[model samples]
Target: MGKKIILLLTVGVLAAYYVYTPLPDNIEEPWKLTWMIAVSKTVAYLNLFSEFLGANRFVNIAALSKRQEVPPTSDENVTVTDTTFNNIPVRVYVPKRKSVALRRGLFFIHGGGWSSGSFALYPHDFLSRKTAERLDAVVVSASYRKAPKHLFPTQFEDVYNSLKWFLRQDILENYGVDPKRVGVSGSSSGGNLAAAVTQQLTEDPSVKIKLKTQALIYPILQILDMNTPSYRENSHFPTLRKSEVAKGWYDYFTTDRSLENAILLGQLVPAESSHLFKFVNWSSLLPEKFKKGHIYKKPIHGSSDVAKRFPGILDVRAAPLLADDARLRGLPRTYVVTCQYDVLRDDGIMYVTRLQDAGVEVTHNHVDDGYHGAFFLLDLKISHRIINHYIDWLKENL
Candidate 1:
């Protein structure tokens, strides 16, 4: 009996080692990496189980959170309110201090790959309130409709509508915010939506209330070329695998999953749109330092037939990287944060380059030890410092 028990224990230990040892090189700490791997695998398994049960996995996971458990208003000097903008639900955070002058306004969108993120989530909730107090600004965190339920343009519409609503004189005066000092920001898919809003406003000069600044945190700015430098480098990184990233875009863009396989394999670029390739081609855009050890090959022609079926993939609002240079000019000052290990790193870098070339003032911050989801790791000393730096930059710019 004792010998049998010892053998079983040995097998269990070996299985755990096998599962957690082969982490990506970018993750420097072994203990943290192991914990992250375990958490990721557990979530994956839970999501699979939820799928089998025919339930919304994200909603189920979110149900477990302690809702609105942010720091007390008295302590944080921030007031939190739940409200709706144009009938779309939103959460607003305002600093309590009375101001002689109107404060800056920020429209913050949460990141969840256009699906799972919610302001109700602890990190986001705390971050919003903390931002309002720390920056002494009126912060509005939007809850836009997600994809696979509402579809492509719906998500963008919600965000755009909310921004317009916030800029109204009545709303601006009520929150002690200056209309001209308003800015838009987001992370990941939220960043994509923020860029879309900025692009939309830039194209239509008739809009009276213009944005003063834009902040993007490791945003997925474009989908034209999936073979970016960071994409190739972190292809199978556990935090966010390249295949999974492609699937998220596919799910958001199309109702049918039939074309997903082709899309993932790089067979979606139409021949007529080939000229657009130069904007996203890694060989042309990325610095030599990022392309050192990675091999570059000519991408096989994606089926134009498949590409024609999904025209929105090329839309400037959907792929802001393709926006005209003229449209990029006379826009707000921008702040772009890139993570060294994130698959979306090059997307931010390319955006900064374009913004600078267009004569837009840009402040680019690259977190050397950061990963795609590093912002969620508030407990880690490194992540905490990075988060502080990000907040500090926002305050200074505001």
Candidate 2:
């Protein structure tokens, strides 16, 4: 065991040195050096180190895993209420401050690649109370059923049902909120759910309640094509990657792993889907402006097996960018935030174009120095500067 420990330590040091040396002279803006730091930390936590370092890595992982459950800070004014929304769990945040009548309501969804996140995983009660206090709004963060266990439509249904409950119970009136002033906001995968909920609301007339606006921070708006310029550039980026994003969607929607094989075989969609569906224009609808740093290329055709495995890829809810002109036109005012170095950046840009073209009011903020998962890192002392800027944007817009 002693000899093995020595050998493992030697190999780990060698590998770490190889990965760290010869760094790029100009890594560019939006691509921060901290990303490389995060990669190294991930490696350390994965137990790829030698026996000597194994204990340290295990300790680090344990600390991080534990921190995920720790409360953000001690505050007695913020109260968290855990209750069921359509049989799904949800957390509501109410500030202990005096406010004007009829406060604005914010429906928040937490992000975790659509599978692993929970209501308790986020400091939602804290952040939501802060936002509510500053903006004079009520924030309700829903805990939708995760994927692989609950599937795609299930998560969607859970959120939709929560919204219905919010409306049916006259929550706005009960909480002194103006029904017309309600809004929805989320980050990453939750951002995707927020967009989906908004889209679903556009077609549901039975619900007269209107969503005043939508706040999407680095949202994943499309799924059919993973070959976007950002995807190519950040395919292997830490925290989030094209392959991981694809795998996440597959795992969320199917009970069997064979769906992945079917998607690769082009069997997800029917042979006539090309003509039946408008994926060409939908996928290629990106604006020319965002293409400034992008190199244009013709899209390759998918295999038959690829279509069979993931047939639901064509659904607009799975790929909001594919929604028709009418639906886009009907959507409420939108605020989209994108990060330049993020893989899903182009999706936000293109969706903005589609919304504006469809005659919807749209406001956009592009975070040039940001990465995919940067928004959630705001609470960390080191990342507070950037995360505060995002919060400021939300405050101003909301």
Q: State the weakest 10-residue window (summed lDDT) of model 2.
A: 21-30
The TM-scores of all predictions, comma-separated, are 0.92, 0.81
In model 2, the runs with Cα more than 4 Å from the true position are 1-67, 70-76, 122-125, 261-271, 275-284, 292-309, 379-397
The superposed Cα distance between candidate 2 and the true structure at residue 344, in angstroms, equals 1.0
Q: After best superposition, candidate 1 residue 145: deviation in angstroms? A: 1.0
lDDT of 2 by residue, 164-188 (tens): 7776536667766778778888878
Estimate the lDDT of model 2: 0.69
Regions of candidate 1 where Cα sits further than 4 Å from its true position: 18-29, 53-76, 293-295
lDDT of 2 at 64: 51
Count of clashes in candidate 2: 24
> What would the per-residue lDDT of candidate 1 be over residues 90-127, giving only the tens digit for each residue?
88888878888999899999887786668767788777
Looking at model 2, residue 201 earns an lDDT score of 89
